[model samples]
Each structure stands twice: as C-alpha cells, then as structure tokens.
Target chain A: MSSYNWAPGFIDDGDRAQIVTSRFQYEDGHTLDRYLATGGYAGLKAALARTPTQVHEEVKAATLLGRGGAGFPAGTKWGLCPEGKWPRYLVVNGDESEPGTYKDRLLMERDPHQLIEGCLITCYAVGLSQCFLYVRGEMALAQERVAAALNEAYAAGYIGRNILGSKFSVDIVLHWGAGAYVVGEETALIESLEGNRGMPRLKPPFFPAAIGLYGKPTIVNNVETLANLPWLLTHSAAEYMAIGTPTSPGTRMIAVSGHVRRPGVFEIINGTTTFRDLLYGDEFCQGIRDDNELKAFVPGGGSAPWFLPDQLDLPFEAKLVGAAGSMLGSGAVMVMDETTDIPVAALTLARFYAHESCGKCVPCREGATWLERIMERLVDGHGTENDLDQLLEIGQTICPGPFPHAASERLGLAAVPFPFKMTTICFVGPSAYTPVHSAVTLFRSEFEARIVKRKLIPVSIGASDE
Target chain B: MTRLNDANQVLAREIIGRYPKARSATIPLLHVAQQQNGYITQEAIAHIAELVGATSAEVLGTCTFYEMFKMHPVGKYLINICTTMSCALMGAEQLVTHAEQRLGIKAGGTTPDGLFTLERVECQAACTEAPCLQANYRYRYRVNAAQLDQFLDDLAEGQLDAEIPAHGVVARVRQSIPVDRAVSVVAPDDVHEAPVWMPLSGTTA
Candidate 1:
C-alpha cells in the first residue's frame, strides 16, 4: 500500500486552504494508519451524531458545488431523490476520463479514506442503503489503493452493517469500468454500471435521482464532490464558507498542463483566482515554458472552446467564464505558447472526439469524424477553401447554434450564451464542434494559410505512368 | 478458444455475486476472461454469457464498446504513447515518432519479434507529466527518446517485469468481499419498506 511514490507537482505552499489535498504531501498517506492519524472518519463520527436532515442541511449551507464537469450544487442534487423513496442507492463517479483532467485520479489514489468517509456520511444523510464506486479501468494504481482501503475499512467496522455502532448500515461495492470516455457523463455512467454500452439516456424520464440503476432511486456524485464532504463536516459549514468567494465558497483543484513551467495540480481559491493568477502566479504555474508568450489556452478540458491571451484576467467562476464564451469545465487548463500550430492543435482534439464517439448518435459519430478528415487534409496541405466552410456546416448539424466564441467581441457578432443548442442526445456532439468553432472563429488566418498553400501531387495510375 | 479453469470459475462466481443482478457482472467477468487468455476467446465469451444469464452476442456487444478489450492477440507488451492536446503541446508526437522508428513498427503495428506493440493513444490523464505512456496500463511519465529506449530495453530484458506485468493483467491486487458482510440485497420489487438501517417512523437517533 505504501509503494506508490507520488510524482512531483502537488503544491502545498500553505497559502490557500488545502481541504482535500492536505494529506497529499505525506508519504504512506494512502494507508489506513496514516489516514486515521490525520483526522479521518472524524467527520463521519460528527455526522452520525446529528440527524440525517441536519447533516443534509449543513452540507446545503456550505454550498459545495460539484467538482465534476457540471458545477451543480451537491445538496440540491441530494434533495432530488424524493422523500419517501426507500432503498436509495449512492453511486460515486470515479471514472475520471476527461482529457487534461487528472484531479479526481489524484484524490482517489492519495487519500481514499477521506473519500470513503465522505461516502459514509453521504449515505447516512441521503438514507441510501447501498453504494457503488465506479472507477476507470485504466487507472490501475487508483483501483488497487481504493480496494485495499476498502478492505481495511470494512475490517475496522467503518463500512458494512451498523458502521461505528450506529443504527445506519450501508454496503460499498467497488466497480471498475472498461475504457470509454462517454461514461464520465452521469447518465452514461449509470448505463455502463448496468452492464450496457455507456450511452447517455434521455433526460426527464430517465433523471437518475427519480429512476436510475436497477429502476430505483439513485444519486451519482463525483469523486471530488464527495471527497469534500469529510472536510466540510469536520468543520462548521460557516467556517467552510468563510474561505473563497461568496458564490464559489471553497477551494478547487485545477490540473494545469501544456506549456507551463510548473504543470501540475494545484488547489486554488475558487471564483476569486483568475487565469492570469493561475498561469503567472508564483504559487501556481510560473508562466509559459521557456519565457515564451502565451498564445491560446483551453480554459477547461478538451471539450471547452479555446481562449486567447486577452481573456487571461477572467476568474475561475463558472458564470464569469461561461459569460465570456467558455467554461471552467472539469478544471483542466491547457496552455499553448507562441510556438503552437493552431490548426494542428484543433485537430488533436478533433481527432480525440472522433475516435471516442460511442456511435449511439449519428451526428456525433459521422459529423465529428467528418470534421477530423477535413482537419487532417488541411494540416497536410491538401485542403481547399470549401473545406473550411464544410467544417462549420457539418459542425452546425451537430450543435446548430451561433457558437459562443471569445472573438465575438472583436468580430461584432452577437454571442450566444451557455448550454448551446444541440441536435444530439448528449453534449459529446457539441464537444466535437467546440474546437472547430473556436479555431475557425479566432484563428481563421492559420486555417486559410494552410489551405492556400495546398500542394497537389500528380497521381500515377499504372507502372507505365511512372 | 479456452474456458475458465476451476480457480477462475470460482473467481467468476465471486465477481458475479458482488452485484444484485447477475447481468451487471458482465464487464468484470469479461476482464477475468481476458486475464485468463491474452485476448477474450470465443469459448470464454460464451461461458461468460452463461454465467451472467446473457446471450453470446450480448456479451460481445458490451466487450466491443470498450477500448481496453482486444479481440485479437497482441504482443507481450502493449505500449500506449499519448498524443492528445496537452501531451501534444509538449512534443508527444515526436516521442511517438521516436518509438515508431526504434520499434520499427507503425502506430498500430506489432514488432516482428512479437515482444512490443505501439499505439498512439489519447490522454492518459498524466498530462502534467506530458509525453507519457503506459506499459500494460502502468504509467511511465515525462518520457524522452532516451528514457523510452531504456524503458523498452528494461521491459524486453524483464528488468521491469515486477513493476509492469503482462498486457492482460490489469492489476495484481484483486478485490474480494465476503458474502456475510455484504448489504442485504434483493430484487428491486422486493424493496417495499424504508431500508432496514433507517430508523422507523418518529424514532430519533
């Protein structure tokens, strides 16, 4: 269990509140002894002392937002399970597959007891009888660490039947998911847990809290979202609210990669911290790599639209970033310096979504792959002028909206808001269109330059033609 | 084609018991099947369907949707070099090219010696350690051409066998939960009252 030597880049400068990551700096932190020594399960003890409604209200008062892609409030999502529903199930979404996002993976590997405690408190509050932890299959170390932690906890009476001598009893099962990016979405995650293709079910009738896994009431919370519960319950909700901005009242982990001197995961004050503070601040990534100037950055994971240098002062708040034509989705910031090739950068993401399309939706399957083909030809200097327009036209078939772009300020085109219109079942279709919309809108000159320098090689049909 | 041996059959039953519905155990059983044989054999797939109460086609459908399950036999070591956006920004493509040249095989091709298979993959969630790759799903981060060469040499010489297992072995640690400690589970229709753990009507904690 102590074999994992943590890679460098987990910052613990003591400047900000390290709620979830406080134990990450210590060796053997994943072990039960280290976890118990570091004030683990104290939250569950404190929570068990209160009524279920009281524990639920305290979490609501703290205003803990989901750290997964969507920033929905955790308390409100818990309250949606309908009061009289018996035998509710809690499903923890540990399948952290979003590209550029690795924060949840760290949480699961470093301090699994904290997450296990969080789940205990949550199941007690939500009146859930059973819990399922769904982790990605590719994360071998994380799975082993969590499994060992669970074995230790069960033997210690932290899990299974009347935990800690309380009337509340719950069972926690760890399930591993095979490789599929679509399962990161909650509904798709539920489908995958049922041993089906990880395709997103339609909303309204299929809302998880009402009718979910095995046709019973279920609540799916992110790994990081539940990981915060232990810390929130150990301290008062007001104490938790005292830190960070009023709206986003807690610290959040942002995984910064790409051309940065210090590319790693750092816990920063939510909403108050700006992109400039993150990229250039001494406590965070110390500016672009090799003294190079920042060209463009994806404010979120690969699904987000690209942001230019002009938007560097924007804060980490969801509303602020959403208003400015992108989102802090998944808290994965990817920076590109002056040496970046814009078309190729866009194609890298385009190719990913194309390869990952579940093929359940035709627009995402066909349209994303179609866009990748054009991007490949364009990058290879074999594209025509019509290919650029074709990329947008095909993208429009998937998303079908005036795309939210940062260039709308300069171009004078009216900017559409967040929750872009989509023709497909889930956001994967629109996710594929984001790179095309961003690259074509902001870096038109780059695409045009590549296409204008198109090279046409003569074809030799037979041996005689050579 | 091969079937699960006596020990794997016992393991398969334990995996199936973890779920309330036998069908929910489909994916895990597929993993066990792959672990038994490098690639999921036709016989294993049929056997899994019988264990999970699913048809063979249904089992195949679920297996094909995931990227990790390989239908055909691969090399002894599976090296996945990531070239996504973050990794691509850090010259991950160049690392892939170097690997291709040294291995003398293209992205999806296996080496002639049947020892190595290289694939240019998407993000491995190790972006900060850009230009990363996974040998049989165990991560090797911040890799350069020299590091890759040394890694390949070590892998070929069995120097890193303890760290990185064969391609089909996901992890050395297997999860086993005894039945008595498990939650009281039944069919969805059988759950009528408030859960046994929840305090009845006006009783306070």
Candidate 2:
C-alpha cells in the first residue's frame, strides 16, 4: 500500500487520534478503550481542573480555525460566546452533508471517540454543561458509532456528573438532523435539533454563540474544528500555532473528489500545502485523467467559485480565494477534466441547488430554478447570443456582489433585497449563479455555437448541429 | 419473534417523547414499526400514523421525503447502493450490477426469497471508501462487484458479525448483520449498555 508523507509541521508523535489518517484506525468496539488509553479525556480532565477562562485562552492562543468550510477562527468565535448564561450549550455540527465533503463522515464513523474528546474539551472551555452533536440524519452508522462512544464515555465517568472527579459536569447528546444541505449552517442545525425545519436564521442578536438553542447561549463548532480541540488542549496555543500560517492555524481536512486517481480525504497543515500538491500527489490524483486538458475546478465544494487551470497553484485560503472572486465555502475540491461538458455540469449543479432551495427567499427559490432552465436550454443547443449575456446578467442579479448577501436575506423573506439594495438576495441565490456564470465565461464559443442565427445551435462540437 | 413487548413500547414512547408535536414523530414511529415488522407495510404506516396522531398523508409524505423511511416492504436485509456523484465516479453502477446479479433483483426491488432488497440512494457521505453501500445502515465501504457477492453470501450464511474494532484500525472491514436487525434483540454481549447515557431529568442536552 502506498503512503503519502506527512506534510511539514504535522504532529507526528501524539496519540493516534491527533494524526489525520491514523485517527480512525481503531474499530467501533475498541474505539472507546483505545481512546481512553491514549489520553483522550486528558484535556477534559485538565480543563476541569482549570477555569473556563483558562481553557478559552488556551484555545484562543492555539488559533484554530473552523474546518467546516467557513474557516472562521474557532477560538475567537468561542470567545465571543456570551457569559453569565448558565447551562450554555455546545453544539458540534456533525452534519457533514456537503455533496463532495466526506472527511467528517470518516472521522465520525471511524474514530468517534476523538470527536467526543474534542467535544468534551470544548464544552469545558465554553462553560457548557451540555453539548449536542447534530449529526446528519443520513449518517446512521456514524450516529450509531457516536452513540456507542458516548455510552462508553458516560460509563467511564468521562461524561455526565462530576466528570473525571471534577465538579464540572458535562453531558454529550448525539442528535441527528434530517438530511438537508442548509442544516449544515449553525442556526439551521439548531432548528433541526429543536425538531423544526432546517432553515438558516437571520443573524445579529440571534448569533448562536449568544442566543441559540432554546434561547440559551450556545457555541456551535464544526466536527473537524472540535476534533482539534483535544490537540490544542494538550499542546500549548503557541505550539499549535507554530504549524500553520499566522492567520490560519492547525491542519485542515480536505476532501478531494471527482476525476482523481486516489480520491479520499487528506489532512494538510493550513498554508503549508497548495492546490497543486493536493491534486497531483505523485501516486494519488495522477494528474488529470486521459491526459485531457484541465477545465475548471470548484475549489471549495459546490458553493465556491470555479477556478481555471492556471489558478490551481493558488493557496487554499478563504481570503486568497475571495481575492480570486471565489469563496472557499468548503474545502471540498472537485476537479473536472477536459472532455466533460462544462455547461451540462453547471446545469446539473444548478438544478440541485434549485431543487434544494428552501424557497424562503425569492432570489434563491426563483433565481436557482431560472438559472437551471437557462443552462438546460444552453446545453441543449438552444442558447442564443443574448442568452449568454442574459445568464451573466441573471447571475449578477442573484449573487450580484463578490460576497453572498447579508444573513438577513438568507433567512428573511425573498422580497427583501440585498443589504445594499443591490440585486441578489442571498448567497445561495448568488452561489447558484457561480457555475452558470463560469460556464458561460469559459465556454462562450461552445455556447455561441449552439445559437444559430435565429434557431437553437446544433448539438455538435464548436457549434450545435441542430 | 420478540413481539411488541414493554421494552419495545417504552422505546417507541421514548422516541415519540423526543418530538414536541405528535405529527413530527412520524419518522421515529416508522423506525419503531420497521423494527417490529422488519419492513414497513401500509398497515404499519397506518398504525404509526394512528399512534402519532397524524394523517395517513402526513405520515406518507414524511416517509417519502427521507430516504431512510422505507415506504414499501423490503427483504430481510436491505442493501442501499449510493448512486450519488462520489459513489457514481467510484463505480457504484458496477456495485449495483453485482448486487442485482447476486440477489436476482434489480435496484429498488427485493429478491423472490425475501432475503434482500437492493436500492440506490444519494450520497451516504462515505465517499472516502468509494462505491460504498449501506447494508441496513451499517456502511460497507470500498465495495466492488466481487465484494458485494461475498457480502451477500456472508449475510445469507449468517456469518456476519458486527464487531466494532479497537482504535488505530486499518483494513477494509465489513459488518454482516444490519444495525436495525439487532435493534429488536438486545444481544447478551452488546458492547453498549443502555440507560448509562440516558438523562435522568427533563433537562435537554
């Protein structure tokens, strides 16, 4: 079996759970014992011994960033959590439901004990006596594994009252949310946990860290984010920060799929690795298939902007990708090789976002379906010269600016225009426009060929022969 | 058969109590019904709806919306082949073909012997092990046509044992018994002890 070398700054000597791929080596039956033997609950024990502020400072010093697409600073988010709220809840968003994102699924299913350890540490840091894992409902096995691990933890007295002989009492609840892409959002996940529809909520006073989950303060972190907490607690914040760049710290679990030789999840230190090293790893990926020319890549799952071949060397950073007019929404890299029809792929993606749109907002509900129809027409060789411009125009109208619409538009009524009174309503609506816009921008000739003088262009190379 | 014993009723009631409204309890109720009946039947749906105080339409709609809630009767074991993009690129079609050949039933159908139900679904999020299948909610990843055959044989011969290995584990492993299959009978050696994690008070976690 081929093994890739660990990237520089990777903690190679710690427990198996801290290592990227070694974490899940244990089976479900032995996970709890193995985890316990490896100082899994040591962080929680240590934190219970210290004050919540001490735990928070240790995490903040580590400079850990959220691994659930957003890459927000985990410690800062936790620090912003409101104080004086007793029984604060810590929710670990385990709804790894992104289409191309599977890293969390592997972690939750294979090494659930590690996640439990991370959650316990986080709960202690945030003064939360109760923490709930909102696992994706589709992940039935993962749910079972985590549920089993929680039982083991409780029986061992690592969880429940007086954990590890400390006065700090913490309980971990494993709850599953009905499968939905939007539920991955923190607020939507909270709603789903409360037995409501999975829908994103408007922000401001309702930020989950302050007022969340039964109107109590809650700290919601991603699976990978919480999974890193145990490591941060063991290692000092400065030591943990020594690995990644100044802004982004710790390792990121990148799930690369589509048209790759060895498609799987990999743990790479933030800022130490580039897109090229991830895609063209000597044995893995094996470069683009069929020696076909590279087309575009959805750098961050389906929501991020598409990157051309020239941009493959770009660093995987949120700000950098944003500078390139693409947000690294999720570190799910989807590579599309040559010979694949870009328009068709965009249409398929558009249809998905359209169908899955919560229909709460006008732009997302109406705009996604509209983009899908236009892309279908374009791919079917019925596009006109004006259609290309129309698609771009529509994209601007939906996702208009570089950033997604304000949180209000995402949660409020569709008629509520962009925060700036611009065209698009929310990120989903504008995000739906990304693939279609990229397809048109990159393959204008192909689209133009389809539009014949007055009729739909024929469905042939260069030009639609219809 | 264990029959609808008090333990089963208590489990059912506990699941119902999780939901604030009875109508929202449809899926959990269906899970309980499926646990008892093996496969959900129309009668089971009606019974669940009656228990949950929901209309047949509400129950049916809830069942159809989620992939886990099976509307029709399935074989003794259900093989959910993930046809999502990740699984598709990983040769999920070949896996489905292998399953069909082994069971003599196509996707979304059950075999004549009522031992297996084969179906395709969206991503189960086990993309790392491409071409993965969920044999009754327990993932069997890195599967191909031949692996599917061996798995079916193992299940048929009752050689399947669900043993969760210890940590630091490598090797593509398969669990023979479906998770739901063991839900009815509490195995004597079950690693998980119930009520240990169950909260004693009304406080929500």
Q: lDDT at A446 for candidate 1?
A: 90
Question: What is the iRMS for every candidate structure?
Answer: 2.5, 10.1
Worst 10 residues of 1 chain A by lDDT: A1-10
Q: What is the DockQ of each candidate?
A: 0.55, 0.15
TM-score of each: 0.95, 0.76
Model 1: residues >4 Å from true position, as ranges? Answer: A1-6, A408-416, A453-466, B199-205
Residue-wise C-alpha lDDT for candidate 1, range A1-466, written one tens digit per residue: 1123445546665478878988887777889999999998999999999888789899999999998888888998888886566668899999887779998888888888999999999999888878899999988888888999998888888898778887888888888888999998888888888888889988776458888888788989999999999999999889889988778989899999999998888888888899999999987898999999998999989999888887899898888888888888898999999999999999999999999888888999999999999999999998899998999999889988677877445556544456688888888889988988898888888999987654679777758742
* Candidate 2 per-residue lDDT over residues B9-72, each given as its tens digit: 6666655543334444454455556566664567766666676776667666556544455555
After superposing candidate 2, which stretches have Cα over 4 Å from the reference? A1-22, A25-30, A204-206, A283-286, A290-292, A377-390, A401-427, A448-466, B1-5, B13-30, B37-65, B71-120, B128-135, B138-205
lDDT at residue A16 of model 2 (Cα atoms): 17
Instruction: Give one digit per residue, the lDDT tens place, for model 1 in B1-205.
Output: 4888889999988877777788888888888888889878889889999999999999898999998898988888999999899889888999999999999999999998989999998888888888889998899888999999999999999998888888888867776665556666666667767765555651222
Q: After superposition, how far is residue A266 of candidate 2 from its true place, in Å?
A: 1.1
**DockQ, candidate no. 1:** 0.55
Assess candidate 1 and give its lDDT. Answer: 0.86
